[model samples]
Target chain A: MKAFQSVAVIGLGSMGLGMARSLMRGGHEVRGCDLARDALEKLAAAGGSAFNTPAAAAHDADVVVVVVVNAAQTRAVLFGPDGAAEAMKPGSVIISSATMSPVEAQEFAARAGEHGVLYLDAPISGGSARADAGELTVMASGSPEAFSAAQPALDAMAQTVYSLGEDVGVGSSFKIVNQLLAGVHIAAACEAITFAKRLGLDISKVFEVISKSAGNSWMFENRIPHVLEGDYAPHSAVAIFTKDLGIVSELGRKQSFPLPVASAALQLFLMTEAAGMGQDDDSSVARLLAQIAGLELPGMERSN
Target chain B: MKAFQSVAVIGLGSMGLGMARSLMRGGHEVRGCDLARDALEKLAAAGGSAFNTPAAAAHDADVVVVVVVNAAQTRAVLFGPDGAAEAMKPGSVIISSATMSPVEAQEFAARAGEHGVLYLDAPISGGSARADAGELTVMASGSPEAFSAAQPALDAMAQTVYSLGEDVGVGSSFKIVNQLLAGVHIAAACEAITFAKRLGLDISKVFEVISKSAGNSWMFENRIPHVLEGDYAPHSAVAIFTKDLGIVSELGRKQSFPLPVASAALQLFLMTEAAGMGQDDDSSVARLLAQIAGLELPGMERSN
Candidate 1:
C-alpha cells in the first residue's frame, strides 16, 4: 500500500479547515483552497500551502478531498469550468466528503473514473473538535485501490472508518440516511426542550434528567445545552440541515419513498430558516417552535 | 414521614403489572386492581393481592397508585361509581401515573382534594423492562405532602424522579413534552432506516455504521434492531404514540399552540395505526414507510 504524500483539501470552512490541519499533522504536504482569501491566507500562515483554484491544488496531489456544502458545490469543486478533475493526474483519488445525493455520488464516481482517477464516497461526521483531534467518523466506500490510496489520510483524520462496501454510491447512501436521522433528531430535540420550557419546566432540569433517560438522543444531549445557554452560535447551522435534508427529501422523493417524519423535520428546519434563524446553531430551531407556540424562548425572552 | 406499609395499584397491564412486582420487591403489601381478571390473576401469582375493584384495593391502602391507560381510565379508577377515592381514608395519597393532559391532571388534583386526598401528578417513562427492573423514570409534581406520601412507592418503582414543582399539572406537562420528542424520534428513525433499505443499501451495515454516527438516537439504536431481526413483539406498541401524540395535539389545540412537528408525527403514527400495525411494536412504523414506498424491508424477507 503506497502512502499518500500530498493532499489537497478544497473548502476551508470549519470542517475543512480542521481536516486540513489533521492532514498536515499526519505529515502530508497539504494544500488548502477556498474562495475566501483570508481563509486561504490563514491556512498558509499555519504552514500549509494556499491555492486560489481547486485545480491548482489538485493538479499533482495524490488525494483531493472536496468538503463543500452540497451536491452542486461538490460538482463544481470536481468538474466546474476549472474543476479539479480536469487537472488531476491519472490514478489520483478524489475523496468526496460532502453530504450529497447517492445518485449524484454515483455520477461523480463515474465521471472521476472516466478521467482515469479513483473516487471514494466519504462523508464525515463529528464536529470540528473531533476533526481537529483526528477522531472523526468517516462513512467510506470505493474500489479497493481507492481505499488503499486514501487509508493514510483516513487514518489521520478519523477514529472510526466504516468500510461500507466496494460500491462508490453506498457510502453516500448510508451517509444520507444518517443525515436524515441526524437532522430530524436535532429538530426533534429542539422541539422537546423548547416545548418543555413552554410548559414551565426548568430547561436545565429537563436536560439533566432526559439526558439520562430513553427520551434522549445524541443530538438532544449535545444540542440542548446550546438552547439552555441561549447560545445560537452555529456549531452546526440550520442552513446545513436545509441542504442535507433537502438532499434527503429529494432522494426519498425520487425513490417514491414516503419519509413523512423526515419531511416534517425538513419543514421545521425550513421554518427556522424562513424565520431568519438560519445562521444560528440548529438548536435555534427551538426558538422557531417557541415563536409558533406564542411562548417566548429563554434566549429570545428579551426580544419582546 | 410515615412509611407506606400497604399500597394499592390500579391497572394490571404491562406497566402496572411490573409496578406491582416492584412494589412487592420493595416490601410493600400491594393489592392490585384491574378490569381484566387474568391480569389481576397474574399479579396475584406474582406475590401481590388481587382485587376486582379499585375500592376493594384502596379499602386498607396507605397509598394508591393509578397506572391506568389515560385520563378517562384514571378518573374512572379514582372517582367512578365505586372509586378508590370514595373508599380510601382521608389524607391517603394518590399517584396518577397515566400519560395525561395538564388540564386533566389539574382537574384530577382538584377532584382528589375534594375527597380530602392528595394527588401527585406522576407520569412514568422507561417502558416495561425498566418497570420490571424497578428503574423507571417518574416526572412528578404535586403538593409537598403528596410527594412525601408517595415517596415509598415512588422510590420502589423509579430510578429517577423529576420533581417538577408545586403545580399539579407540571409533571404531566413534562411527560407530554418528552412524549413529543420520543414519538417523533422513533418515527424519524423508522423513516431513515426504511429509506436506506429502499435504496438497496445493506441494512445491517447501515445500522452498524449509522448507530455510531451523529444520526444515532435512542430510538434508532434501540428499535432498528427489531426491524433488522423482523421481530416486532411489542416492546412499545404503535398505538402508544398515536395516543400520546394525540394528547400533545389536543393540548396544543387547546393552548392555541401550533405544533407543526408534533402534529406531523401524530399523523405518521396514526397512519401506522391505520395500516393495521396498531398492535405491533412501535418499530413497525418502519414497515409502514417501506409499504408506502412499495419497497421490501430487508429483514422482513423471512416472512415473505
Candidate 2:
C-alpha cells in the first residue's frame, strides 16, 4: 500500500487523541492539534508531535483526519483563518470524520476540490475506546483516488470502512441517517431501562433478558450497563447527540420530511442537555427518564 | 417435562400454527382451534385435532395455549359469550400469550384463579419462524403451580423462557416494555432505511453498514430484508404494531409517562394502516416514509 507517513489529526479530544495514537502505532509520523493545552501535552508525551493550531499540524501532511466537534469547527480547521486547506499539497487527501450535515460536507468537498485536494466524507463511529484501538467504523464516500490516497491512514484507524459511494454528500447523508437511529436507540434504551425500573423488575435482569430478546439494540447493550453501574463518565457525551440529532432534524426539515421518532429522540436529548447533563455520558439520558418517572435505578439514587 | 399428552392451542394464526406443530412434534396430542375453518382444517390435516370453537378443543385438554391477538380477544375467549373458561377442567393450565396491559393481565389471572384453573401470563417473541422450530422466547410469570402446569407447553414451544417473576402482571409488563422498544426500533429502522434511500444510497449497502456500526438494531437486521425484496408478506403486519404501540401509548397515557418514541411510532403505524398496507409486513412502513420523501424503492416502480 502507498502509505501516507505524515498524518494530521485535528481536535485532540478523547476521540482525536486515540486516532493520533493509532496512527503512530501504524508507523505513521503523526501531528495532533487541539485547543486544550493539557490534551496536546498528553499527545506529545505519547510519542507524537502536538501543535496548538491546525495549520501547524497540517503542513506537509499527506492525509488529514478532522475529528472536530461540528460543521463550524470542522470548517474552521480546514478553511477558516489560517486554514489547513491552503497549506496542504495538491495531491494530499482530507478525511473528514466529524458528524456534520450533508450540505456542509458537500461544500467542504467542493472547496477542497478547488484546491486540487481530495476529500473523503468519512464520519467515525464506535466511540473513543474503538478510536483508541484503531478499530473505529468509518462511513466513507469519495472518489477512487481519494480512497486510494487515504487507504493507509484509513487502514491505520478504522476496522470497518463502508464505501458508501462516490458522491460527496452521500457518506455524510449515511452518517446522519445512522446518527438518527443511534440517537433514537439510546433514548429508547433509556426509556426501556427506566420503565423496567419503575415496574419493579430487576434492572440488571431486565438488561440481560432484553439484550437476548428482540428489544435489544447496539446502544441498549452498550449504554444500559453505564446506567446500571450509575457511571456518568463521558464515553460519548449527551452533547454529542445534541449536535448529531440537531443535524438530523435540520436535514429532515430541509427536505420537508417529518421524522417523528428522530424528532422525539432529539427532544429527549434536548431535555438531557437542558437538565444540565450535557457533559455527562449519553447514558445519563436514563437518568433523565428516571428523573421524569420518579424512580430509582440499581446502584443509583433517583436523579432528582 | 410433565408431558402434555393432550394440548390445545386456541389460536391458529402464524404464531399458533407453528406452536401447535412444535407441540405435536414434542409427542403431545395437539388440538388446535380457530374461528377460520380453513386454518383449523389445515392443522387437522397435519395430524392434530382441529375444532371450529374453543369448547370442542378445551373440554379435556391438559394444557391450553392462548396466542390470540390482544387483551380484548384474550378476554373474549376466556369470559365472553360461549367462552371456554367454564369448559376447561379445574386443574388445567391456561397459558395466555397475548400482548396485554399489566392491569388487564392481572385481572385475567385473578379471574382464572376464580375458575380454579392455573393461568400463566406467558408472552412469546421471536417470530413465526422460531415458533415453527420450537425455538421461540417466552416471557413468563405466574405461581409455581401455574409454572409447573405450563412447563409441558412451554418446553415444547419455547427454547428460552424468561421467568420474569411469580406475579401475574410482571410478564405482561415486561412484554409491554419490550413492545415499547421493539415498536420504536422497527419504526426507527423504517425511518433509517427510508432516509438512506432518499439520499440516493443503495438500501442493501446501508443495511450492511448500519448492521456493523453502532447504528445497528435488532429490528433493522430482522426486518429490512422484507423491504429490500419488495416482499410485503406479513411476517409481522403493520396492524400488529398498530395494536402493540397503541397498547404502549395507552400504558403511557394511563401512567402519565412521556413515551414520545412509542407514541410517535404508534402514529406512524396508524398512518401505515391508513395507507391501506395494514396487513402488509411491518417493514412496509419504509414505503410510508418513501411516499413522504418522494423516493422509489427497488422493485417498486413509483415513489409512492
Put down candidate 1 lDDT per residue, B94-148, tens digits, no spaces: 9999999998999989999998899999999998989999999999999999999
The TM-score obtained for chain B by all candidates, in the order given, is 0.97, 0.97
Query: Which lDDT tens digits does candidate 1 get at residues A49-167?
Result: 99989999888999998989888998998999779999999988998999888788999999999999999999999998998888989999999999988888888888999998898
Candidate 2: deviation at residue B286, Å?
0.9
After superposition on all C-alphas, the RMSD of every candidate to the true structure, in Å, is 1.7, 1.6
lDDT of each: 0.87, 0.88
lDDT winner among the candidates?
2
TM-scores for all candidates: the values are 0.97, 0.97
Poorest 10 consecutive residues by lDDT, candidate 2 chain A: A295-304
Off by over 4 Å in 1: A2-4, A301-304, B298-304
lDDT of 2 by residue, B172-272 (tens): 88888888899999999998888877667788888888888788889999999888988888999999999998888888778777787778888889999
The candidates' DockQ values read 0.74, 0.78
Superposition error at B295 for model 2 (Å)? 1.7
